[model samples]
Target: MSTPELHWFKSSFSSSSEPGDCVEVARTPAMIHVRDSKTPGTSHVTVASATWESFLAYVTE
Candidate 1:
């Protein structure tokens, strides 16, 4: 699917001082889509929702 078709949003933890430097994410029922805010639509990584949750838990800890 195209990036535009997805509703992308910047992470709340993203640095507001540098507007261009951030991570954007989109979501589906079973997948989490991630991409660089600077290079939208060019490439992205898709991961299972469970995996994304795990990653978040790891990092937040």
Candidate 2:
């Protein structure tokens, strides 16, 4: 599949004032995109909006 037009933002959970390993997050109308900041263009994962929310809720619980 073609890559979606996603504008990724670094997660608020990240606390690195320096450049190193990090995770990025982006959201579309229907889904969320997640990727590594160091390897922005090549490594990533995606999930449906509902699934992403569920995952976050679980993590924060």
Candidate 3:
């Protein structure tokens, strides 16, 4: 499938200079898109907005 058109946000904590790991994210009306920031041109995964928010909240807790 073609990549969806949406606004993506790169984490401030991400190191764009050099990296073994990095994450990129985007938001849709009902979902969140995430993928390796280092290889954004590759693949991305989508999750429900509520699940995404819950995961973030849990991680921050």
TM agreement with the true structure for every prediction: 0.86, 0.79, 0.72
Model 2 lDDT, full chain set: 0.84
Model 2 CA lDDT for position 60: 87
Q: Give lDDT per model, in order.
A: 0.89, 0.84, 0.81
- Stretches off by above 4 angstroms in model 3 are 1-4, 12-21
Candidate 2 stretches greater than 4 Å from native? 1-4
Q: RMSD of each candidate?
A: 2.6, 2.3, 3.3
After superposition, the stretches of candidate 1 with alpha carbons farther than 4 Å from their true spots are: 1-4
What's the best-to-worst order under lDDT? 1, 2, 3
The pairs that clash in candidate 1 are none
lDDT tens digits by residue: candidate 3, 1-61: 8866878788655776776566778887899889886687888898999998898889778
Residue pairs in steric clash, candidate 2?
Answer: none
| Residue 22 accuracy (lDDT) in model 2 | 72
Predicted candidate 2 versus true structure: per-residue lDDT over 1-61, tens digit per residue = 8866788888976768766767899999888889888888696787999999998899889
The weakest ten consecutive residues by lDDT in model 1 span: 1-10
Clashing pairs in model 3, backbone N/Cα/C closer than 3 A: none
